[model samples]
Every structure is written in C-alpha cells, then in structure tokens.
Target: MKNFFKIIIIAAFGVMLYPLFDSFSGNGQLNDLASFYAQKENVEKVNSANLVTAVVVTYRGLDTLGEVTILFLTAAIIAFFLTKQSEVRTLRRNSEIFQTAARLLIPVIIMVGVYIFINGHLSPGGGFQGGAVIASAVILMLLAFPNMPFNSKLFGLIESTSGLVFVGIAFLGVLIGTGFLDNAILPLGTFGELLSAGTIPIIYSFVGLKVGAELSNIISGLQSVQADN
Candidate 1:
C-alpha cells in the first residue's frame, strides 16, 4: 500500500513540474527582459562585459547588501551560541600525505577565489562565488590543523571593514551618480578591460572579503563543537 501511494505521489509531482519546462524556449535566444539587460545601449550605461554582473551589482545592488547583512547576522548568532561550549576540541589525526596536500592546496584555492571576484565584471563568477571558494579553503585548514586558534578579532575587523566600504561606495553612487550603486559614478572605462567596469571590481573585492570572513568565522565556530572522541 505504501509503495502504491508513493507511485501516485511521484506521478502527481511530475505532472506539476512538467508544465514549468514549457516556460523555457531552449532556442538559445534571450527573452525580452534579458535582451533589455544586455542591450547595446547599456554598454555605455554600465560597461561590464558580464551582463549578469551588471544586473547583480548595478541594477539589483541593494539585494546583495541585504544578503550580506543576513549572512552577518547568521554568523553572529551561531558564534554566540557556540562560544558557550569549550573551545578545546580534539580532532582525529590525518595522514601525513593528507596534511601535506591540504597545506599545499590552501593557498592555490585562495588565489583562485581572489581571481574570480576581481574578474567578476568581465567573467561569469562574482563576489559571492569567490567568497564561498575562500571559505572552502578555511574548511580544509580547520581539518589540517584542528588546534589552530580561531582569530575572531581579525576576521571580525576584516568583515566589518569590507562591509563598510561596500556600503560607502554604494552611497557614493547616490551622491555622484544618478542612483544608488550606479557603476557610472566613476568612468565605465573601455569595455572588456580589467579596469573597465568603474567601481564594480572594487565593490566585488570588498564583498568577497566580507563574505569570506563571515563564512570562516562560522566554520571556526562549528569546528569548536565537534570532538575527536
């Protein structure tokens, strides 16, 4: 009877999802809204080579700010709760090869993360992605050195400073440009160049740092809770 009910539920769920696929034309043409976003006229307005980034950091910039704020609150809450527990937690030993490999990869991973955010306006990746990549490195570090002290003060300062610069630049857009977070506040420079997207690269760099710091803090807090025994 349970098997019979499961089949019925699956059929019903598939039926609901099937209709959603029709919305995608799959003909490789941009929809009207997408066309507007990447339209040639916009190249002058925001010279970012990556249209998605133009939309994310310029058109819908406020949403990104809110997302960062939410992440900050979440990390703060988790850290608060975890601090009550003893910070001394023992981790099982990792193989020498494993430790060596992790140590070698951590710097490479961090560099890739930096590249992703810095090239955000010209390529597919952005601050959030780069930040997550950086956080992954911290995870590896925690596993490699279980007893490594978590630098709450340092990360807090980095996170706070990065967040402030992000907001400050946005407000600068309002004062100098037509709207908030407008990339046009500074010269949009030649399209496709590294320095082409006005303040976008700078903005994304700060965002990447802030996100990386917040995620690292969360991981440090979590590693404190688990014990080897």
Candidate 2:
C-alpha cells in the first residue's frame, strides 16, 4: 500500500514536470543570442584558444560564480554528514606497492593539475576541473598512506580564505563598475597571451583553490567518519 502511494506521487510529479520540460526550446531568441556571442570578433578578444572557457569565465561570470557556490555547498553538506561519526576507521597498512606508486606519481599529477588551471583562460580546462583533479590526487595519497593525518584546520582555513578572496576580487570589480561582478574595470590584454583574460584567470584560480580545499576537507571528513564507525 505504501509503495503504491509512492509510485502514484512520483507519476504525478513527472506529469507536472512534463509541460515545463516541453516548453523549453533551443530555438528562437536564445539561439540568436548565442550565435551573436560566438562571432569571431568577440571570440578573438580572450585569446580565443579556449573560446568555451572564455564564455564561461568572462561572458557568463555570475553564473560561474553561482556554480562554484553550489560546489562549495555540496562539500559542506558532505562534511556535515561525515563529521558526526565518533570513531574513524583507518586504512589497512599493507599496501606498500600502491603507496610507493602513488607517492611517485603525485608530483606529476600536481604539475598537470596546475598546468590545466593556469592555461584555463586560454584552453579547455578551467580552475574547477583542475581543482577536482588535485583533490583526487590528494585522496589517492590518503588512501595509500594511513599514517598521515589530514589537517582539518588548515583545510578549513584555505577554503575560507580562498572564498573570501574571490568575493573581494568581485567587490573590486563592483567598485569600478555599476554592479558587484562587473569586469569592466580590469584591463583586457592582447589576445592569445598568457595574461590576456583580464580578471577571469585570477577569479578562476581563487575558485580552484577554494574548491580544492573544500573537496579535500570533505574527503578527509569522510575518512574520519569511516575510522570512527
């Protein structure tokens, strides 16, 4: 009887959502607007090597900021769930071969991650993607070596500082422009150059730092929970 009601409710909700989904179209004004933005004149401004990244970080910066906030919130929720456990479980100590391999590979992984982040304004990868990669590498280390304890305080500090810095940078943009996130004040450099994307690269780096710290903290918190349980 309970299962029957749940199925009915889900079906009703799906019926309610169908119209909204059907009404959404990839045609008309939205298509025209997108095409306008994709023109060569605009594309050549931010080096145009990574046109999509420019679109995301500069053309739609506010949306990107909101996305970063969502990631941060997700990390917070994961931390909340994991931090409640009292006895954290430790990884067994017998993976010497795996640990050695991870230790050897960590530096290369970090280098690639940093390269991805630095080139984000001029390439396909961005801060968020690079940050996730770095976090995953750290997680690998955590899994390989059980003796090293993660410093939660440091993680929290980095996350908070990076988030504050991001806001501060955005505020600077506001001070120079009409709104809080306006990038009008920053100087747009020459195209195809390393430092040409105005404030987008800086903002992306800050976002990457904040995201990396938050994700690592979440994973560490989960490990603690496992140890506790």
Model 1, 1-229: lDDT tens digits are 9999999999999999988886866767878888888788976678899888888888889999999999999999998898736546555788999899998999999999999999999989999999999999999998888767778789999999999999999999889888889778788789899998899999999999999999999999887777546
Model 2, 75: alpha-carbon shift in Å? Answer: 2.2
CA deviation > 4 Å runs, candidate 2: 1-30, 44-48, 84-91, 177-179, 227-229
Cα RMSD for candidate 2?
3.6
Worst 10 residues of 1 by lDDT: 83-92
For model 1, which pairs clash? none
TM-score list, all predictions = 0.90, 0.79
**Candidate 1: segments with Cα more than 4 A from true spot:** 1-7, 22-28
What does candidate 2 score on TM? 0.79
Cα RMSDs, all models:
2.1, 3.6
lDDT of each structure?
A: 0.90, 0.76
lDDT of 2 by residue, 115-177 (tens): 788788787788888888889888887878755868878988988888888788778877876
